[model samples]
Target: MTRRVLPYRTPSENVISAEDWHLVTPDGDIAAPEALPDWDYRMNLRLRRVVNVDLDRARTESGLPADAPLLLSAVWTATGSNLSGPAQHLRLPRAGTVPMKIDFELSGTNLGGLLLLDTALVLAERRPDARPASPRRAGSILWSDRRALRLQGDAPQFPMAVIDFSLTSFPDNAAWHLQISGSLESATMGALLLLVNERNTVTATAFANAAKPRQIDRLVLSAVYADAARLMVEHALSHEDFSEESDYPDDSLGATMLILFDRLFPDQSITDMRLRQRQSPSLFASDLQAAVTIFEVS
Candidate 1:
């Protein structure tokens, strides 16, 4: 819950807001801090981002134990749109001593959509006196806080309790790295795996269609739909169980046309079904291509 701005690696662009930070330390074995997951270290950063036409991800950095095993995650939420995006996860190698990049992509061209991001990063090095224990489950949710990504759902709850997370940031050599660790019960882990697989399927389909069509409108439409699907999947996994059903748009082609309609005629209100009816197929095709400019990577 505590927040602090470090001396190194601050965003040059306008920062919206940042919070829900934690730091974890390696009590014994660096390779397996899973044993003593605690020992208090925490800090926070005031950072969050807004949707921009610019093609850069919000950037930040900190110094860590030159070469250490680490795990990092951020809760990315788009509020007004009712989309809780996934936790951007990264696993670092002991040999990686340079800065790492973390990215978040905006879905629709709706700059009005708001994004709130919360981060937790951890580094556990192997120690000479560390105790040997079975490895922690590989697919465990590292961020302990489930409250950050909660959403309203009508689905039934899981049969068992879900996992928990603990986060904090520790400093070494005058630099800091956020640390987070958590575990899940066997049933919860199984649910996570299932949800992850479903998300993968959804994303793979979008990518495939975007490539085959070779149309700007198709790519823009599929990209945003994929982003919304990703957000829903992230929201579902944020819970202890996998009962949450995502409500992303199933029709990327239709949604793209709608988005293009709004962008081309921002003065027009969606409530005007009459205006929508008047637009011909040729006009729709023209506007759709123009909207693709907003989604272009470069």
Candidate 2:
């Protein structure tokens, strides 16, 4: 009999209770920065982070039910270089809206890592009668990390209506191309990981088949980007894959990226390849951080 993997479930009850979620850096320091800014080049060799969002305006524009609890999801994935310091967590306010201050620490110089940010909101409903309870409440039992030997106990009475907001999804299923190019003289090496889907694969394959094999680097880059973007979109849709216990390249976005890269450079053997899902906790069910990987090539 084939083994069936269980789908991870997100906690919904008492989501607005204090300590339900938090903002922290990789080192577990509570983050209180303003906001993560879009890609910035002005910082030059130093790490840069910033964000400009009016939560008050966003809430008013949302037109959601007044009693619904508001949750904000933030994701940061590292690309090009595997530095092993990406963090993801949700924020829920006891009352009112989540704090707009988004803290991201990317200190140090000569940094050659690419970081991507994804943000969204989640609205959940709580049963007013049930008092909010902590995740590890008294009389509550949980399966151990061993996944065996059930510990029987009472289930928390707090019930909730949860909602999911697919990250990386846009209005009208439209495709987006966000690119920035600059001229800087240096000999730096890094790897690129991309997510592709059926649509992007078809489009990229068509373009690759039509273009000459010896086309300029610019054209080659565009083709690769197109294919990878499609794969990324598909991977995002299959978010459950990222929840798997093993985040190896073959099981994650890296597998699809390899296939596309082969089309881009059939003769070259890409070295030090990897595909990583930057997230916290094995069972934390939140699309707070996007899937990203960083590696290098000789």
Candidate that scores best on TM-score: 1
Model 1 lowest lDDT segment of ten: 35-44
Overall lDDT per candidate, in order of appearance = 0.31, 0.30
Summarize candidate 2's per-residue lDDT along 1-298 as a digit string, tens digits: 1222322222322222222123343466443223233222112212222323334443334332334354454444333222334333344453443434444444322122244444434443433442333111211211111011111111100111111212445332323232211111111112222222224444334334432333443344344444344444334323443321323342123433333334433553333111212333222112211221111111
TM-score of each: 0.23, 0.23
TM-score of 2: 0.23
